[model samples]
Target: MIELAQDSGIWTATINRPEKANALTDKMLTELAEIAEEAGQPGGARLLILTGAGKVFSAGADLDAMQGGLATSPVWERLSSAIAALPCLSIAALNGTVAGGAMGMALACDFRVAVAGADVFYPVMKRGFLPQPSDPARLAALIGPARSRLILLVGQRLDAATALDWGLYDRIAQPGALMDAVRDLAADVLAATPQHVAAIKRLIP
Candidate 1:
């Protein structure tokens, strides 16, 4: 499930199923894509902040739904692409662990802020599945080809500090302070004109 809120030009989307480690379902992914589409429409929020409700950011796709094969679903691609194409700046507030396809979702954001002890990994290979088509390029764009290889090929599980150092996360906050850090960044972004921010976001790779 997902919850979306808007206040003073900032839009926040929270993944609400903490009991399942916020593992994504088809409906949740669809909602994310829909929210992303709405964010680009007229009079939409100026900034978008994506976060998870509890200690796990997302465990990625739900295994039960993958019985037919993961390739049958296009929601992940749609959601990530929609997020990247938004006119306004977007941030992924990584409150906790991020793994598998969730890494692709986080990489789609313009910036990311993770809690100090959060961990990141991409285990597609280990699971005998290839990475999503958009994932490798996006990951490479954020952390460079070498590091991306280590993550995608070597199956490295990076801690928050290493991820920050590799440019995967723009900032790190202490536990229980992730939202505070996000709000501070949101405030700084709000100081700029929406048009200016949108223009700058478009120029980023």
Candidate 2:
């Protein structure tokens, strides 16, 4: 499930299924896409934050749903694309672990702020599956081809510090300070004119 709230110029969306490590279902992914669409509208929030409730950020697709053939890459792509297309700046606040397809969602965001001890990994290769074509390029763009290979091919689970060093995280926050750090970054972003911020977002690749 997804929880959305708006205050002033900021909108926050939290993945709420902590029992399953916040693994996304089809309906949840649909809700995320819908939220992204809403955030893109005129007079919408100037900043959007994506995060997870409880501990883990997301465990990617629900295994049961995948077993039922309900988890498809296209739907995931649609969700990621919707976030990427938003006119406002978007940030991924990684409260905990970020895994598998959820990595793509974070990569789609304009910035990522992570808890210092959170872990990140993609196990698609181990599962005998391939990610969407753009995912590798996005990873490479953030880090580099060598690190991307370590993640995508070697199945490396990167700690937050290493990921930050590799450029996957824009900032790292100490435990219990993740949201505060995110708010600090958001405040800095808010200091800029919304028009200019949106224009810069549009100008970025």
Candidate 3:
């Protein structure tokens, strides 16, 4: 359900279940938590990029896996918190359509750079679902409550341009260049000292 590729201080995690719009299963979320924990260790990584393979980034919770009523399991809260607590710099390269819990994953990152024309939104309300607490809070902090509601509650599918305009994403690259763009952004971020990065991140917000 995922792939990990590392180079020097940069690590990339890719959601691999493209056949299901990369929908995350309970197992997948568990694996993601593990990855986040592993990557958070000092010297293990300076930057971590979260991405998805194939056409759709991730459609959110895998209905198939939740069919037996695993939807209410505590695993979701654990996974969300793990992603939020990860210590290293995290970036989300939204290369395709992103929705539902998958949107929460993207929001967990410190920076989000998506591909232009990509469909990026959280449609939890449309599915009769609610985002975990961390999701809405983080989204509101990143893009403000008004825009957050527009996306989360209203089920607005935001294209890259709209996302950038609302500050939902830091930048919008051409489709198919998401990773390259992320790599460049990572390089820029890595140019700074870790102490400085952490200090600024903490002091400013």
Candidate 4:
């Protein structure tokens, strides 16, 4: 499923199935909802930092799960929205390649940090389909329309440095230093007043 670890006020959620590139499962998504619920409560958790176990962050939803859903799957959207709406500030620490619906999870975070080896490619179009339909607005906000078009339409793979240059990642760290960097970032966030963080984040229209 997932690994939950805590430091002072920071909670780190690690996607643990490295064998499958930490692919998302319906059970995993449901577990995430429960984790979010726990973290949202009083005296529970504050800032949440998400990363993966071995190499890649996540390779997107489980193909078996997706097939099982058929035409009526709401699991993906539900879990993504839950992750997006958590009161705790969220940070994504990408370790490797990201693709397909997995980008949706990364996009939900308030801040994203990646290592040089990390990259992302969304190939829904090449597969003869479009994105989830609601992703355009968020994608535009993070990386702008032109880049988003390049990614979604052309299916270009963006290296970490290129992504940073294009404003995809707020910062980049060496692969080995990523977690340390993320910890420092979480500490900085935890040091701030929750009201200020909430206010400033909300004011970003």
Give one digit per residue, the lDDT tens place, for model 1 in 1-205: 8999998878999999999999888888899889998998878878888999989999888888655565347888898898888888789999899988887779888889999878999887787777877889999988899999999999999999999999999999876788788878777678988788888876766
**Cα lDDT of model 3 by residue, 84-125, tens digit:** 666567898887877777777788788888877567877777
Model 4: residue 128 alpha-carbon error in angstroms: 3.6
lDDT ranking, high to low: 2, 1, 3, 4
Model 3 Cα displacement at 166 (Å)?
0.9
lDDT of 3 at 19: 81
Write model 4 residue lDDT over 1-205, tens digit each, in one string.
Answer: 7988987767888889999988888788777667766776666666877788888988877777767762135655665676677667888899887777778767777778898888988787776555755566778898899999999999999998898888878789865999877777777668887666667667765
lDDT of each: 0.87, 0.88, 0.79, 0.77
Q: By lDDT, who's the top model here?
A: 2
The alpha-carbon deviation from the true structure for residue 164 of candidate 1, after best TM-score superposition, in angstroms, is: 0.6
In the predicted model 1, the residue pairs found to clash are none
Model 3 ranges with Cα > 4 A deviation: none
Off by over 4 Å in 2: none
TM-score of each: 0.95, 0.95, 0.91, 0.89
Model 4 ranges with Cα > 4 A deviation:
70-72
